[model samples]
Target: MLLASYKAIRPGMQGIANRLIRWRLDGDYSHNEVVFEPGDGVDHLMPDGTCEPDASGALWCASSVAWERLPATSPRRPGHRGGVRFKRIKLDPAHWDLVKYRRDPLAAAQHFKRREGALYDWQLILGFVAWLFRHKASRDTCSEVCTEAGGQLEGHRVDPCTLHQIVAAEDRHFRSLLWLAAAGEEAAY
Candidate 1:
C-alpha cells in the first residue's frame, strides 16, 4: 500500500530563507509536501494528474498553495523557480494500522480543506529566531501541513528540514528516500 511521502523543493530563486534552511538542515530541500496519492502511468511521485485513492477514498491533498485539490502536477509557487526532489519513502506495510501511521496525509488533507484559502504562514520563516514565541495564527506552512497531516509535529515550530528529520527518526524503517526529479531529467529511483 502507498503511504504518505514527502517532497523537497529547490526553488531556483535561492532566496535567503531557502539557503538558510539548506544550510541549517545540511540538505537541499527547502519545502515539503504530503503525497495524498500516487500518480498513475507515471512514477507515483511525479507531479501528474493521477492521485490514487486509499481504502478511505480521499482525493484531496493538504496543499498550502492550491485552493482546491492538489494538481496532478506540482504547482509552481509564485516566486519559486527550482526543481523538486521527491523523497522515496518505503514504509513497512505492517505499520500501516498503527495509530501513528493512520493520522497523516489523510488527516492533513482534511485539515487543509477545512482551512482552505488560509494564508501561508510567512511568520514561520522566523521560527528559528522566535523559536520560543509560538505562532497562534490560523495559517499553515508547507512543512507544517505535512507534519500536522502526518500527526508528527506536536505544536512545535519546525522548518522543512526539521520535518524531514522528525519523520525519519519516528519511522526507523524509513529509507533515505531521495529521488531527484530535476528539470528535464527523468526521475531516478
Candidate 2:
C-alpha cells in the first residue's frame, strides 16, 4: 500500500530545523515522506521478504533527506551521500498524518524507488526560505519527491503543510488512512 506521511516538529535538537520551516512557512507539518508496505512491489527493500510495522505502528518510508544518517534501501549513487533513501521510521500517531493513495500503490512505489540516492535539493529548500537564494537543479527535496511520486500537486514546489492541505481537501485521490483517521473525523495533523 502507498501512504503520504507528514511529520510535525519534535522536541530538542531534532526539531530545530522543523521548527524553523514551520515558522517560515506557517505550516503545522515540517516534513513529508512516502510510506511503503511489503508485497507492494517493494519487496527488495523489506527484510526477509516481509515488512513489519514497529510498536507504534510505523513502517518503511522513502524520502529525500538532508543531514540524516539513515541507510538507503537502494542507493542510486553509492558514493554520494544525503539524498533519497528508504528508512524504517517509528511515527507517533499523534505527530504524524497519513494519507492513503487510492490508485496503484506499486506504480508510485516504483517511481519513488528510482529516485533513491538522488542528491538533496538544498538550493530549493533555501529558496523556500529566501526567494533570492532559490536555485533549481538535479536534486530532490522531501516534499517535491513525494508529491511527484504520488502524482499529487505535480510540477509544484510544495512544502509539508501545503501537501497535507491538498490531500486533506481532495478526497477522490487521497484519504486519511484508517489506522490514523478517527471514526468519521478529520485527521488532526
Candidate 3:
C-alpha cells in the first residue's frame, strides 16, 4: 500500500501553493510510503497457529531509512492538516514472486535503513522548481528512497508524483485503497 500526502487548500493566496504543486506535478499526492506488513490487533491468521495480536507485526512502514511501526488502524499521519490516501497494487504473478520470494520490499527497506543518515535533498527540490532533473549522490528524497527500495534505479531525481506516475505506467497493478480528507473523514473516491 502507498500513503500519499495531499491536503485541502483553503481560499485566497494560501491555496495558491497547493494549487501550484498539484498543477505542476499533475497529481494531488506529494509524498509516498510503503506498508510492509499488517499491524497487531487486526484479524489475520498467523504462522504460529495462534489467535492474538501481533505486537511486533503492526503495520510496518519504511520511509527514507526511518522505520515506523504503526497500529493497523492508525491514520496515515495523525493531526496533520494535509490529507492522506492509501493505495494497493495488485502485482502480476511474476512481480509478486519477485517481491515475495526475492523479498524485494524488505531489501528495499533495508537499503534505506543502511543509508539512514542521508540528508534530505533540498537542492533537488530547487531543481524541481527550476524544472531540472539532476541527480545528487549525497542527498535523497522520499520518493527516491522508496523507488530505490523497490529495486528501481531510475529514481535518482524523481519527485513523489513523478515516481508514482512512472511506477503506475510501467506496472498496471496500482489500485486505490482509501482516501481521507484533512479532517480525518474517509471517502470512497
Which numbered prediction scores highest in lDDT against the true structure? 2
lDDT per residue as tens, model 2, 117-141: 7788888888876788764556788
CA displacement after TM-score superposition, residue 22 of candidate 2 (Å): 0.5
lDDT of 3 by residue, 96-187 (tens): 22111122544654564455545555566567778575556766666777677677676666666776666665444322222224234533
Assess the local accuracy of residue 121 in candidate 1 as a C-alpha lDDT between 0 and 100: 62
Score candidate 3 by lDDT: 0.47
Q: Pick by TM-score: which candidate is best?
A: 2
The whole-model lDDT of each prediction reads 0.46, 0.69, 0.47
Q: Give candidate 3's error at residue 4 in angstroms.
A: 5.0
Q: Write out the backbone clash pairs for model 3.
A: 39-58, 39-59, 108-149
For 1-189, candidate 1 gives per-residue lDDT tens digits of 122333333346445556666677676456555555452222333333345543455433343531223232433332332222222223333312111233434355445445444556655556655676455456676666666656565533666666666565655543322222342265342
The candidate with the higher TM-score, 1 or 2, is 2
> Candidate 2, after superposition: displacement of residue 12 in Å?
4.3
